[model samples]
Target: MSPSARRRQEAGGKTRPGSPRHFLRLDDLGSGEVETLLERAVALKAYRRTGVDHANLIRRVLGMIFEKPSTRTRVSFEAGIYQLGGHGMFLSPDDLQLGRGEPIGDTAEVVSRMVDGVMIRTFGHHRVEAFAAASYVPVINGLTDSYHPCQVLTDLFTWYEQRGSISGRTVAWIGDGNNMAHSWIKAAVLLGFELRLACPEGFEPDPAILEGGASHATVMRDPRAAAQGADIVTTDVWASMGQEAESDDRERAFGAYQVDSDLMAAAKPDALFMHCLPAHRGEEVTAEVLDGPQSVVWEEAENRMHAQKALMEMLLA
Candidate 1:
C-alpha cells in the first residue's frame, strides 16, 4: 500500500477480516475501490428509477449523530437508508446525552451495539476518530472540520456519471481550503487527476494533505489561471458553517474568487460547473452560472443519496 493509504487505514482503524471498516477519509478506500463504488452508485441510481427492489440493507439500522445542521446530508442518508430496507435514527445534541457531557467513546460503544453502522457530522475530526476506535460497527465521517469525505465521494460519482472517467482530467477548485478542498486533494492523489486550487493568499488547503498530493495538486492565487484548461470547475461558500463570525472578513478576502461567467469562460467550453449547494447567488458563484446550462449542482445533490447508499453497503458488506 502507498504511504497515504497506509496512514488513512491506520487513522480509519484496523479491523479483522470479518469486522467492519471505517471511512474517516477518502484515502481510506483505494483507487479501485473508489471506482467500483462509483459504478455501484450508478447502478443504484438506475435501480431507483426503475423501482427495483434492491433492498440489500434489510433489517439494518444506521445511527446518524449530528452536531451540525444539514439539508442534504440528513435527508439523503435518512431517506437512502429507508429505501434500502434499513432504519435511520436521527440523534441531535438535544436528543443525545452528549450535550450534557457524555463521553464520545461511551456514546459510540452504546450506540454501535444497537445500530449496524454510525455516521457522525461534528466539528472536529478527532471526535469521529474517537467514536470509530470505540465502536464495533462501521463508522462514517458524515462531515468533519478536517474532511467531508462523503460529499467528495458523491461529487466523484456525479463526475463519473457524466464523463465516465476523471483520471487525467483537470479539476479547478476556487474558494476556501476547507474540508471539501481537503477531500478533493485526497481524491486527486488516489485517482490520478490534476487538481488546481485557487484561493486567496491565506486560505489554502491543509498543508500536509496538499503536500501528500503535491504531484497532482497545485495551489495558486489567480482563479482564472487555475480554471484555465480545466474540465471541472467547482467552488464552495466563502464562509462555511461555524465561520459566520468571520463573514465580513471572508467576504473581503474572497471577493475576487467568485466563479462568475467571466471566470467560467476561462475553463474549457464544455467544462461543468459544480457547487455543494445552499449557494449564494451573488457571492461565491453567480446566479446565471449556477442556474445555467453547464451547472450540474442539482444532479450532484441527488447523487449524494445514490453514492452514500453504495458506501453504506460497502461498509456493511
Candidate 2:
C-alpha cells in the first residue's frame, strides 16, 4: 500500500476503521497527497480492467446530496459506489431538510451521524465548507460555484492514462472560465503542468484563483496564444447554468475564443481535445473538433467513475 493508504488506515478517532474522508478543494491537499490519490485511482482502474474484485469498501454508504441537477456527477458517483461494493444515496434538494430552511451545519451534523461519507454538489463553495465544518465524517465537494475538483481530477487521470504524465505538458483552456477552468488552474499548479487560459475580458476565472495559479500558469487574452504548443486544448460552455441572461453577450464576446479546427491545429499535432461536457457545440467548440479523433471527452467522462471510486475508498478505507 502507498504511504497515504497506510496513513489513512492508521489515522484514529473521526477517521474510524475504513472511513477516511475529504472535502472539495484541491488546495485542501498538498502536492504529495494529490499524487497518492491519483496513484490509487490508476491502480483501481487497472484492477477493474483485469476483472479483479478489489471491493475494499463493501457495505459502506456514501450520501450524495445534490442541490443542482446533474447527469454525469450523479451517475458516476452512484455507479462508482456500487462498483466498490458500497451503496449510494442520491438526495435531491427537495428531499432534505436543507431545502426547508434547516441550517447547513445542522444538516451536516445529522448526515455525518448517518452516513460513512457525504458528497455534496451545490451552488456555493461556502456551503461545502459549512458542511465540512459541522460534520464529523468526511465530505467530498461534488461541485461548487468556485471549483469542481473531482472533474479536474478525472480529467488529469485520463491524461495520465493516455500520455503517462503531465509534468511539463501545456494545457490550454478556452471558454467562459467557470468552475471547471478554476479547477484546471488548481490542477496545473499542483501538478506543475504549464497552463494557459483564454476567456473574454470580463468573464475570467476568480482573480484569487488566477493569481494563485499564476506562479505556475500563463493567463492570456488570445485563445490561439494559449493554444500555441499546447499538448491539450480544452473548453466549456460560454454561459453556465445560472448565467442564462448573459448568454447573448457572452457569445458575442467569446466569438474569438472558440476551440475549432484552426485553434486545435495550432496546438501540437497529437494534442488532445477536451471539454467538460454538456457542450455548446457551435458556441464554445465546433462539432468537428469535439467529435474528432483526438477528442478524449468520453474517456475523460469514464475516468470520473474510476477517480471518484478511488476517492471514496481513500476517504472511507
Candidate 3:
C-alpha cells in the first residue's frame, strides 16, 4: 500500500476495501486518493459539457439529509446524482422521523438499508459522525459546523482545473475562520498545498485545526501577510448562516479581512479570487473583486457539480 493509503487504514475508522469511502473530512483522504477524485471530476465535467452520457453510477440511491437549509448544496447534489443516472432522496429535518424524536442510530440503520450512500448537511459535526457510525453504507459529510469537506474538495478541483497542480501553490483565505477555513486546512495537510489564513484575532481558525497536522499551512493576523505571493485568494462570509445574531459584531471584527483590490494586489499578479457564495457585497469580498477578471467564483460553483459527481461514482460504483 502507498504511504497515504496505509496512513488512512491505520487511522482507525471504517473504510471501503481498496476504495476510500465515507468522505467525512479531507484529512481522511490521502494525496493519491484526492488526485484520483480530481482526475475523475475533470473527465466527468468534460463529458457533461460535451453532452456525453456517462452513467457509471446507474441505479444507485443517495439519501440526502439536510438539517440546514442550503441553495448550492441541494441543487448541486441533486443535479449531479440525476446526471450520473442515479437518484437522490432529499430528507428535510421535518420529513424524517428523527425530527419527531426517533433515535439517530435507528434513523441511520433504516436509511442504510434503503440507500447506497448518505450525504448529510447539518449543524453538529457529531451528527454526521453518529450517522457514519451506524451506517452500513457510505456516509458523506456534505457540511457541518466544523467542516464542509465536499465544498473544499470542489474548491481544490477548481484550482487544479485552472492551475494544473496543487503542490507548492499558495492559497490565501481572508474572512471568518469557520467551517470552510477548517476544511481548507485539512485539504492543505492532505494535498500538500500551502494555505495561509487571515482572520480577526478572536475569529481566527480553530486553534486545534492549525496546531493539528495542518501546521504546514500558516495562520496570520494580517490579511496582507496571508495573501502575499499567493496563487489564489479565497474568502467566505464574515458571519455564516447560523451566526446571524452576530452580524454587526462580525462586521466589526472582520473589517480588515475583505478581499478587495488592495488585498489582491498582495497576491501574485495573476492570482485567482474565489468565494464560496452567496457573498455579501462590500463585506467579506467586494463586488468589483467578485466580478473582476481574476475571479473564478462562477467556475468554482460550477465545478461543485462535477466534483461531487466523481465522489458519488467512486463511493457508489
Candidate 4:
C-alpha cells in the first residue's frame, strides 16, 4: 500500500470494507487511484464525444450543497451526473435546514441517507470534514477555503489528457497561495511531480502543507523563476470568492505576479497555460495570454465534468 493509504488506515480513515470513500483531499486517494481516475476520465470524455451511452452511475443521486457561489462546479456536476444516468439536486444554504442553524453533520447525515453522494462548496474546510465524518455516503470537496480538491484533480486530469504522464514534469503556480495552490501541493507530493509556486510573501500557501511536499515543491517570489522551463504554467484569481472586500489590496499586492506574456515566455515554448476560471482578464492574466494559443482554460473547465464523473463512480462503488 502507498504511504497515504497506510496513513489513512492508521487514522481509522476507513472503518469497514463497505464504507464510503470520501474525497476531502487529494491525498485521500492513493496515487494508483488517481491514475485510474484520470484514465477513466479520458475514456468518459471520448464516450461523450462519440455519443456513446455510458450509464455507470444509473440510479445514483448526488446532493450538491453550496455555501458559496459557483458556476463551473455547479453546472459541471449537475450535467455530469445527469449524463451518467443519475440526478443531481442543488441545495443552497437557504434551500435546506442548514440555513436555519442546523449543524453541518446533521444536515450531512440526513442528506446522505437520501443521496448516493454529496458534494460541498463551502468556506471552511472543516465544515466538509465534519459533514464527511457523519455521512453514510461519499462526500466530495467541491471547493473550500483551505483546499479545492476537485478543481486540482480536474487540473491534473487535464494535464494527463494532454501529455501522457506528469510524473517528472514541472508545474508552475503563479498566484495567491489559496485553496487551489494547497491542492496542487498535495498532488505534487502524491504524483511525483515538481511544483514551483510564486506568491507575494504573505500570500504563500500554508506552511504545513508546503512542508509536506518539501521534496517536490518549492516557493519563490519571482513568477518568472517559477515559470522558467515549466511544462505547465497555471494560476488563479488574486482575490477568490469571499475575499471581495480585499480586492483592492490584493490587486496592489498581486500586480507584479500576473501571468502575462513575459511570464509565459519564461516557460517552455510548448508549455500550456491554465486558469481555474471566472478569470479576471486584466488582473491575474492578460487578454493576450488568456486568449492565446497556449491557453487551455476552456478544455480545463470541461474536464471537471469528466473527472468528477470518474470520481463519483469510484466513490459510489
CA RMSD of all predictions: 5.0, 5.3, 5.5, 5.1
Ranking by lDDT: 1, 4, 3, 2
Candidate 2 lDDT = 0.85
- Could you give candidate 1's per-residue lDDT for residues 1-317 as a string of tens digits? 76533433454333344446899999999999999999999999999999998899998999999999899999999999999999999999999889999999878867876778998999999999999977778999999999999999999999999998899999999999999999999999999999999999989998998899899999999999999999999999999999999999999999999999999999999999999988999999999999999999999999999999999999975
Encode model 4's per-residue lDDT on 1-317: one tens digit a residue. 76533433454323344457799999999999999999999999999999999888888999999999899999999999999999999999999998999998778757877788899999999999999877777999999999998989999999898988999999999989999999999999999999999999899999999999899999999999999999999999998988999999999999999999999999999999999999999999999999999999999999999999999889875
In model 3, which residue pairs have backbone atoms overlapping below 3 Å? none
| Residues 1-317 of candidate 2: C-alpha lDDT, one tens digit per residue | 86544544554544455533575887667777777777888888888899999888898899999998889999999989998999999998799999899999878867777778899999989999888866767899999999999988888888878887788899998877789889988888888988888887887889888999887766689899889999999988888878899888888999999899999999999999988788878888999999999999999888899998888887877
Stretches of candidate 4 exceeding 4 Å from the true structure:
1-18
Tell me how far candidate 1 lies from the true structure as C-alpha RMSD in angstroms: 5.0
RMSD of 3: 5.5
Error of 1 at 185 (Å): 0.3
TM-score of each: 0.94, 0.92, 0.93, 0.94
Return whichever of 1 and 2 wins on lDDT.
1
lDDT score, candidate 1, position 123: 97
TM match of model 1 to true structure: 0.94
Looking at model 3, residue 135 earns an lDDT score of: 73
Judge candidate 4 against the unseen true structure and give its global Cα lDDT, from 0 to 1.
0.91
Residue pairs whose backbone atoms clash in candidate 1: none
